[model samples]
Target: MAADLEQPVAGALPVKRTFLLIGTIVIAEPLAATILFPFIYMMISDFGTVQERYVGFWAGLITSAFFVPQMLMATLLGMISDRLGRKPVLIIGLLGSALCVFLFGLSRSLSWAILSRALCGLFNANAGVSRTAIGELAHNRGLNQGRAFSLFGFCNSIGYVIGPLIGGYLAKPAQKFSWIQSGNLFDQYPYLLPCVVSSLYSIIVSVIAILLLDETNQGISYPTLTGSTVSEETPSEALAEQDPLLTRLKVAAARIGPRNSTWYCIIGVGCVSLHAIIFDEIYPIFAASAGDHGLQFTSKDIATSLSVMGPIIFVAQLVLYPFLNDRFSSLGLWRTSAAVLAVVYPLFSLLPHISENHQGSSRIVQWVILLVLLAIRFTANVVAYTSISVLLNQVVAPEKRGTIMGLGQTAISLGRAFGPALGGTIWSWSLGNGLPPPFDFHLLYVIELLLALAQVISSLGLAKSQSVYL
Candidate 1:
């Protein structure tokens, strides 16, 4: 971590290996984040402590536990990364996440599970630092900033694809898979198999990062976008000359330094994160809930669909996202995707209706519709997140990149902290209380659509330029 080198110009950059390393970082966090989603409610159920009617409430809180500490500590870690360098922070976050998530899997009760998740969130600042590292790495390579960030987004899509497979298939190995069920730790902990697998992968990746990853901080930050070199004085001076609104944002992020485009990107990510989390928390609960209330799916059934969907999302990102940055403004592309999501959420809400109205049709038909709608919705959201991440790195100088990106993660994490809890309670209330049509599980999607529209509107306030930093 302490190894240092003079900042390299474009031709001297380590393109392939650096991408591989950061790509692992990008995928590992989400892998850990989502691997538990398929079975978390079931884990809580196994505790047998929460009543059936309120399981939704507890499940949401358990999921939210990971993000709450992440929200609180992201910026602090980012600052730490800036001072100490990205490699050490990355190692700490990766190893810490592995330990914490492994602890959660070994937990005997809900309280222990929640504590494990919270500690995991507190220590895993990998998302922010990884972005920080990618931004600097790509910048040093004189690459299209969008291309580097797009690759990370693509890896994220891969994570979504793989995480659920591990969660769905590997969890409860004692019950789901035979062979050594009698002797394995999974027989005792039940959920430990997947966590153990994910933790081992994380530990392996951390060791690779420790050995191969280089420190990006040179104690100086370069300010340029789209490979256009410029003077360091260009950014703050450009903001000071803009209208009063820009000045206000500058003041808001002044403590962190160089807030203009970065702040806009963070606001955009926050809106998307809020909508994304509601989907994350609400979907599985709605799917796994019993009776005629929802899909009434088993954990394996949910995993089956996700394993299918994750690959589709990955291919779509690979095929479609590469063309985006070249053709559209970052904010424009993001807002357009957000608008598409606004439209798709309603389609997502139509699934239960299809089930009720067409009882004689193949159940496969409903699953197809659900998969299509989810693919569209998640793909759009992923594009928005990736594009916004690129915009964040572009708008901020390299020196402050880690801190600002951490702040961005903090903002998104803050939205997510409320998301699981609020979405869980709402879904629980809808299920338990039989709220009217819109207020039912259907209402969660509706609110998300509305938030997407608002995100579109808020994005209009951002600079519409292709590249803003220089």
Candidate 2:
């Protein structure tokens, strides 16, 4: 472990092709996930399965369904990738998620939508696998891990931008555009267009991954009890064959790393992810709501607001992050971002109040304020996620990278699983109960602020405990 900590940073040749392939694969999950954001409210309404007041609840449930199974499966999948290799696991996840996306698009009922999303989450283990692959590929080549991960972040930023555009414009195509008659596949299934596009993107990426992506876990070795190095193939395979379940569980539990630092890092990332997801699930709903509390925006308006995040994130991740990563510790950067998020989260609740204060044409001022706040939040989130990823990857050994990354994903998935459901439930209750100020709609952002502060505290703990690594 000490030797692992002292490993020198390598300045080897770039693995552009491999990074490119991984980035392409990495973008697919976010693309598929965010595609539902813009139209989810309307889609739930179309089902007529719940009352208008409870649409938020059902929408939140469908969103949460995707993460519930993902949380359960992430660590297992990560462990599997460590044994079987990253490429196969990634391709399988991509293809499985693609099929689920199609099913989600075709869903006419809440049950089908929830089931499709759950299955999608169950199959989509690419999040951890791809991160593991990037870490391994960079470590193997002594390449700049920061740059590689930044590219990963860059791809995610693009997906976040493009996914909303696709969902906002392509959804309900028969109603939005007119060249065809009313009795078509798109007309019959209004949300199918974006899903088809998202699914096809995944299928194409999966095919590309099969053809081009190389396995990073191949040649990696681990230490045995007798101090001999065992090849990747023999140890895990032998252990699994010897004791299928218990040994693997024991090994996984053992490799989770120092509880103080490793778990802090995991918890820190999880907290940030929880608030970010809650914001993602609630923002559009808040904006589209018809009452004085909302922005009264359409799906297109929501999409446009979200689309602006792409370029902001692109600039932040590609340009600002590299500079900051070069100057400060990843832990330091993460801590700063968390502090900023603590300030930003509560500000979102103020948007409606800001708009309410201003009347008529001056309302444009509120839009400006909204975009500025979003830009800051998105920037902070990009910094936090990218920095924590680098920190998590650095904290573990190369051989256990997959498991650690998977554990990290598990933390994130757990937060996402509950963020939407909790956010939606609270939002509905706040509105329906006629709660007073601070207890009303503001309640959600207050919770988000608390999480951000917790993230800040955890980052401080991580810094103190892992000072040498930082």
Candidate 3:
């Protein structure tokens, strides 16, 4: 082990600009959503009048639509990055994303909204590119790979925290402008302000990236474990001679077969996406409904809850996760936390029913239940996500990092896309005559149970799979 540690690992080409490139992209992509989400329901409601119960479905789609295209395109983007240095690809993706944000501001119909978001997905390769770029940059700079990944996660959490605050406050005009009525401007032009802000941010960040970010795909030159040296005659030729391991991994992941890491990750992330769809996509609807049971919450209140959630998540990632990971393996953390969610998510589904059924009781009961639900879900999320991230960092080889990371990103996007639709469909189904109060409770419970089972399976599979550890 000591000899292996002494062995000179592949050295990455030092690039200071890589940090700016990574940080800017890391901050921009999530900012697009955080700023836009506060007014998503308003956008949907503005587009069309939705039934009270089905509102969750509409809100859920806002998230799902944005992610689906990214999910579909991640592998291709990863492959492209490997072939054509990361900078050009990053520029194209960011430019496309900026265009999408502008288009989202201009969208006047639901179809247009969907189209714009899908386009954003297609171009939103920032996360994947940054991950690949940073990994190479880190290796070149002689930085620890796990630490590099942790830095990305840390920056992401910070973005998540700040973005929502910007959305919650900055996106909204105080008392409306001179020509616009107090609330009419924001209500009528739901995505207008936020989207514009997002576009400008993307453009600025992209410019910085273009000027500063250097290409790391100079021909590979490194000593292998077997004493063989790897290199390319020219940087251009490097693409054609990429390690076979990356190719095999991509082939394995992209296959329709259910046994690969892609499938497990897809299923795992899909389960998590469903809850996000429920909590984020559905919660606003429930918040709106709070008045019937006297829990009255405005859009601002909902925004506040979301904003708080982001920071809390950031703290968990930064302060709590390292300690937790020290005690529990990623798979162990995933299984244990998922088991908690299996129980907690369904109980959460019952809150609205309690509010509706016990109308004469104090509304504090419902509020307490809501808070507890949020706490449990958030805790589970912190534990499960950090574990997965650490595992992703540990599992694959440096050469295949780009493709593997993209695979995970793609799975997340796909899950995020479909999750809302599933939540909405279930919510819609449960609102009918023969069902129990808060009709969707059973569906939420069932989905979570299925997810827990999949988590267990994934844990076992991951434990058996081979990995490279530093």
Compare the candidates by TM-score and give the number of the best one: 2
What TM-score does model 3 achieve against the real structure?
Answer: 0.77
**Rank order by lDDT, top first?**
2, 1, 3
lDDT of model number 2:
0.81
Stretches of candidate 2 off by over 4 Å are 1-14, 220-259, 357-360
RMSD of 1: 6.0
* Cand. 1 TM to true fold: 0.87
Cα lDDT tens digits for candidate 3, 1-470 = 12212334344333444665676787777776555555665666766666655665666676678877777888778777777767887888878888897788766777888788878878885577677777665543344434455556666655654555565554445433455466675555645666777788889888987887667654322332122233433221232144443344334434433245434654565566455545555555555554332234556666666666665666666567656665655667767877877777667556655666444554568766777677667767666655665556444445566777677777666666787677666755665435654443466556756766666667666654522211
For model 3, what is the error of residue 119's alpha carbon versus the real structure, in angstroms, after optimal superposition? 1.4
Tens digits of lDDT, candidate 1, 257-284: 4444556678888988888888877777
- Say what the RMSD of model 3 is: 6.5
Deviation of model 2 at 311, angstroms: 1.0
lDDT of 3: 0.61
lDDT of 3 at 468: 24
Cα miss at 437, model 1 (Å)?
A: 0.5
- If ranked by TM-score, best first, what sequence of candidates would result? 2, 1, 3
TM-score of 2: 0.88
Q: How many residue pairs clash in each candidate?
A: 0, 0, 3
- Structure candidate 2, residue pairs in collision: none
